[model samples]
Target: MKRLIPLFALCIGLPAAAQTPQLILESLVAKAGPASAARGEQLYRAKSKAGKTADSCAACHTDNPKAVGQHVKTFKAIDPLAPVAQKDRFTDPAKVEKWFKRNCQEVLDRPCTPQEKADFTAYMISVK
Candidate 1:
C-alpha cells in the first residue's frame, strides 16, 4: 500500500514525462488548420445549457482561462488552464485528452473535435 501510494503521487505529477504542450498543439494544428484565438474564445464562452453540471467551459473554467476555477458540482479548485498561469497545465497529452473528454461531454454534451481542441489550446497559450 505504501509503495502504491508513492507511485500514484508520481503518476499524478507526470508532466515532465510527457510531451511538451507546444508539440501536441502543433500536431493538432496540422490536423485542424490554423487555430483562431477568437473562435476559441467564442467556443469557450458559448453556453450549451444541455448538461446538468454546467452550461459551458466558462461555467467552471471562468471567462479568463488564466484564472483558477471551481468544479461546478464538486466545488474542487481547478488549476488555471492557461500555460502562462500554470506551466504544466496541458503538458500531458493523455491528461489533456482525458479532461477534454470528460469536460466536453459535461459542457457540450458531445466529444470535441480536433479543431476545437486546437483552437482551445491555442487560446490557452495566447492568454497573458
Candidate 2:
C-alpha cells in the first residue's frame, strides 16, 4: 500500500496529454492485450518488413523521438513524437488516428493493429 502512493502521485501529476494516451491505450487494450512500453519502443525503432526505403519509423522520426523529425520523401519538418518534447502530440484523437493510419500504412504496408497503436503510443509517452 505504501508503494502505491508514489505511483498514484505520479499518475496524478501527469499532464492532460497523458490522459489521452491512457484513454487511447485503454480502448486498444480491450481489443488487443495490455500495452507495453518496451514493445512500443521496439515497434518505433524496428525496421519495417514492408520493404519501403524508409524502413523504420526511426528513419523519419529519428532514434531520439524528442528531437524534431523530417519526412524522408517530403523532407517536411515534423513535430516531436514524445509528449515531453511536444505536449500536443497524441492529444487529438482525430490527428492521432490520421497519423497512425498514414504512418503505419507507410511503414507496415497496412494499417496498424490496436496492439501496435497502444504499444507505439505507450512508447512515445514514456519518453522523457
Q: TM-scores for all candidates?
A: 0.83, 0.80
**Model 2, position 54: C-alpha lDDT score:** 75
lDDT of each: 0.81, 0.79
| Root-mean-square deviation (CA) per prediction | 8.6, 6.3
Model 1's TM-score against the true structure: 0.83
Per-residue lDDT over 86-115 for candidate 2, one digit per residue giving the tens place of the 0 to 100 score: 887877666787988988898889999999
- Give the distance in Å from residue 81's predicted Cα in candidate 2 to where it truly belongs: 0.5
Off by over 4 Å in 1: 1-17
What's the lDDT for residue 13 in model 1?
Answer: 78
lDDT, residue 23, candidate 2? 61
